[model samples]
Target: MIALLPLAVILPMIGAGVTMVASRRPRVQRALSVTALAAQLAVALIMLVVVDDRGPMVMHIGGWSAPFGITLVADRLAAFMLVVSTIVTLAVLIYSISQGRDDEEEDGTNSETPTSIFHPTFLILATGVSNAFLAGDLFNLFVSFEILLTASYVLLTLGGTTERLRAGAPYIVVSLLSSLIFLSGVAMVYAATGTVNLADLATKIDSVPPGIKATIAAILLTAFGVKAAVFPMSAWLPDSYPTAPAPVTAVFAGLLTKVGVYAIIRVQTLLFPGMFTTVLMVAAGATMLVGILGAIVQPGIKRMLSFTLVSHIGYMLFGVAIGSEAGVAAAIYYVAHHILVQTALFLGAGLIERVAGSTVLARLGGLAAAAPVLAVLFFIPAMNLAGVPPFSGFLGKVGLFEAALEGSTGAAQVLPLVIVCLGTLTSLLTLYAIVRVWGRAFWRPVPQAGEEHPPTGPLDPRGDHPMTTQYTESRRRAREAARRRMAAAEAARLPLGMVGATTAVVTVGLVLTVGAGPIYGLAERAAGNLMDQQTYVRAVMDTPADGAADLLIDPPGLSPAEPTAQDPGGTG
Candidate 1:
């Protein structure tokens, strides 16, 4: 299984090429895409079990060793993420295939011929994601990001519509800016330490001057922060994501930002431990508050979910900031939970759009009455996202809170406690926002066509309230027209593929809840591995004298730190 690590990235790349070759055959493309992802998922699961049982596995590209050539490593953290992400990509691909490109304009865009670029681009995106998780060096990670971002650029503006183009503009700008920052960080890391290999950096970074270390850390954080959509850097997300098609939006929401979070975890735990702790905590609280506040006010369901997506990222960041074994473990668990729930919610939002013809809260109503199954589909994930009890979301939060409390004993207790409070508040407000959507979009009676209403005030001095009546009546007429259009739409029957795929994702979330113990146990061991740097460094660097191992050239004059399992708070 360890030897098969490269297949995670290779399978998708090959799948992308095959998909392009079969682009003329949509069914063939779909079959190829699904088969490739299913294989990748299987490989990832096997890697997870192997790494968890036998420790981190390292694969040197072209028979070159670490710090000298490209390396792909699958540790517990990387393997776990690979499993969760593969599940999401596969589910989203299935859902998209079921929805079909013919329904592309179903999201309200002008009708056009469906493009074949989607399957190839999607597989390429999956390849990028897998590569990022398994990348053993900063430069390889950077390359992985570029691969995915390039694929995303094509996916986001797939149809070349005005809305998608408009959204893609800022998204492209922000992504390019982040990529530039990340590239600069990689350059500086190489210059400072003479290697971009992560395990080697863990050992050698300590020898660099404090100022250089802090500068590199700050630079990397800024770049990854933008990628992760953390708070002030997060403004790009809600505006950018909602314009893409449903499946595109679902996969992006599920995996892309989490990859950034994964990078942040590596940087904080492996390269520069204990740097920027306070900054992460403060950023997490602010991200939660501002994101949820923005969420509650959005008129459209996708935009609202996007904001909540931003808000929940803060939770993951909070866990990283806590920098404890428990904190990181909880964060890891939460990341998996959020990926499934958030993806499901977005898919459910897509279903709602299909059923009601629009996702605008004002334009949507009586969904529960019209499509009860869709109502249930949307409701479960929404509740889970809101951290409702007995769900994985709630359990993940409880773990975070517990970790915070345990870590709050020292002089720095105040900040962690305050963040916990903010996290709780965010959860409550998220529930409120979810409920508001449920009421307006699912419970309230659908507006009748040409429904009439009384004037807001008496007639103006001229005994005619033209301003109020004109504005009010026009808005009312538009709403009624929307209602009539939706009512006239073909019966709201959801495609089995979309619903089954979504339900599959939702079931995975429930599996998280039911299997929280074993899964979180895996997270704890992953967190343990992250805190103990030598387990990773040795796996990559140590060579067996046995001829069974490949010929290796050791990095000269570089002394790695001794093998001591240090806590995340340790200042090396």
Candidate 2:
């Protein structure tokens, strides 16, 4: 059964290759891609259940021994991430099919370029993600990143339009540079240590001097920081992600940077275990500040959402930087919650752009006039993103705060205190940004005859507003009924095949919240297993090393997750 685990990853890689060859046909590609992802998701879910019941599962490729051949292992944490990544991919893929249909129908085009390219690259992206999470070796992790990055370059520029070109170029440049830096770090690590296997490195870290390990750690962190959109390295993300078409934007929002977070978690815990505190704390502080500040300044709905995504990412990193079981659990919980809420919000943002005629708040108005049900959808996830209570977001944040509180540091009082203040302020800023979107885009009236050509204002941290009554009685009544018929329209709007793809994926996110208790338990158990490292080592290697292991990752502060080292599935 464990040997079969690698086949799950293999299936999607094969599916992606086949889809790439058949890109000229949209329907065949959709059928195969959805089938591939559905199968992957099923496998991931099965693995999750199996791991829960039977403990972590590990497989060595080419029948090589642990820390020798490539190892694909599934622990509870990684399994949870596999499920999340696969689910997000499935959901947004369906959204893409619906997104481009209008032009396809209008132009008598059966195969739109972006829609056709979407399936192949999306599956490839999924494959890369699964590989990253399952990789037991550092070099294999690097390879996983390259696969994901290459797929992203295609997906990011799917349509090859001027706007996409403008957006994608920076993403490509930055991403490529980051990859190179990461590669350089990988080379240095191999030179310094005999093997690149994570478990091996963990056991071997005592042999490396602090200075040598620090240099390697700095190199890897910079590369992944760029990938994750941390503070200074985040410029490309807000610009690129927002300008892509909606479904692409949604997936990018939901999945891409999260991978970077996964990498950061992997490297900091597994590679530089105890040394992550000062630098990570500083990075987390800056990332949250700058990201939310950027969000505050962005004018359009997606752009704001994009910036906030980067901002809130810092919260999870803060937990990891703190490095305790509770912190890691918080990070994991947040990741699961954020994937759903962020993707949902981005998709809803796309709906706003389509129905409202613009993504900027200034141009939109009184969607309550036409699409109030969407307003509710938008509202739920937006509030969730803001870390409001009763939703998973709030719970995740509270957990992190508690972890931060219990841990002691020289700077502890200030860092945790600042985190609390910033969390509140950022939530307010996020709410403020969302409300600004609602004010002009949903609550107020659309511009009257020749009132203004819009998305026409400067991006502002705070926006100006003029209110009006845009919809009359009939329009208002129709808006109220939109809620009841939302699901029907969601189905009717898509052809049968397209509808099925979306329904299946979105259902996963909906279901995640339903089993929140068990999920949190899994996340916490995984965190505990990670902090101690004995369970993970035994799972990967079949036996604990008789002597010292090679990689001695510096665990961060004791307040948060100790930085789990298995693949890219970070708890947060």
Candidate 3:
């Protein structure tokens, strides 16, 4: 398990390179993708157990102690990320493979599904994601971004349709620009401190003037803000995500934006921990307000989900801004829950789009009757995503609220109070949006001869024609079909494996919520790790870089005035 830790990060990369070369051969490409992902899953699982049994493991690549050569470290937090990311990718990749004809998709034989191109890019994308999670230095992290972003550019424009081209172009450009900004931040920090390793930088950062530190942080945040979709910075998200195929959209929504959030969390805690509390507080507030508002205005199925993605970014930041162990723990739990829920929800919508033939509310109808089990799958995450009680979302948010309340001393609690209120408001608004979808698409009657061309029903005196008794007949049919079509769809439709795989993902989502106890504790531990830099440092530190004073941020549990060298951040 110890030796396998380093190999886990490197092996998928080898697979990515191989997939890229063999992409022209469909069979070889699919084999490569499956082999690589399965290998990763194995490594991640092994590492998970190893961490549980033996604690964290650290690796200095090329066997040259830290500071001189790049290091790839895996502590509980890093290992946890690896395990979660690999599992998500495995499931998503399996869904993709099942979705289309393997042979035809690999070679683009029919021109409708290109398996060859997707296999390589998707594998490469997963490799990049895993690398990013394991990266211990700034430059390597940037390299991971490039790998993933390049693969995404390929995936986004895979089909080459005009609507896709429109969406793909902006995504590519924005991502490229963010990369440039991130690279620039790396250069600035390097010039100032002479090392790109995170632990080295932590010890060195304080020697630099506060103003310069803030500038570097601002530049880095700009890049991550764009990536993470933090409020005003997220204009590109909703416009681009829904344009891809269901598999591609699901992975992008699940991983890419969250990576940005991860970066934001890492950067705030590592380089500029001193300023994190205030900066994150403001961003969290605005991110929540703006994201929910965007969802409120959007009318399409995927677009609303996209905006909800934007709003939820604030939840992670809330944990960060709160700057307490409990808050960070909640953020960690939220991350794990949100990743599963969001992916499952998007796939559910994809199923709806497949049957109802549109993601827009106006074009969709009577699907609850058409596919009833599909209704349950789609509805559970919708409720959970909105933070409904007894689900993961509510569980995560309740923790966040506790963190916020505890962070304040009565008077400062006003901001937290407002945050809780806004979280509730966000939930209410999200419920309104999803319910609006249900009313229009599921409950309302299927179109009659004349109503096919007309709006489903007459406008009321108030100009609002909401779901009413008109749905009684449709509701009855919806229930029956919901029970029947679930098995029927998977049992019948042989062409779209995406359909079956999506159904399976929904089952997994339910399981995650039901088993949230162990998962929640893991997240809390991760948050605790994140807030305390020394633990991560001691885990990753080899020969400390000379510029130590400028970079150090004490880990969460330690007192600011009394840092111990043998503590988590110290050199072994």
| Best-first order by TM-score | 1, 3, 2
Q: Give me the displacement of residue 231 in model 1, in angstroms.
A: 1.4
User: Candidate 1 — which residues are off by over 4 angstroms?
Assistant: 101-115, 449-490, 543-572
Q: Kindly list the per-residue Cα lDDT of model 3 for residues 194-237, writing each as its tens digit.
A: 98888788889989988888899889888988988887788898
For model 1, residues 507-560, the per-residue Cα lDDT tens digits are 999999999999999999899989988878887886332212321222222223
Error of 2 at 205 (Å): 1.4
TM-score, one value per model: 0.91, 0.85, 0.85
Candidate 2's residue-wise lDDT over 181-225, tens digit each?
999988988888888888788787668888998898889889988
The lDDT values for all models are 0.88, 0.74, 0.76
The candidate maximizing lDDT is 1
Backbone collision count in every prediction?
0, 30, 36
Query: lDDT of candidate 1?
Result: 0.88
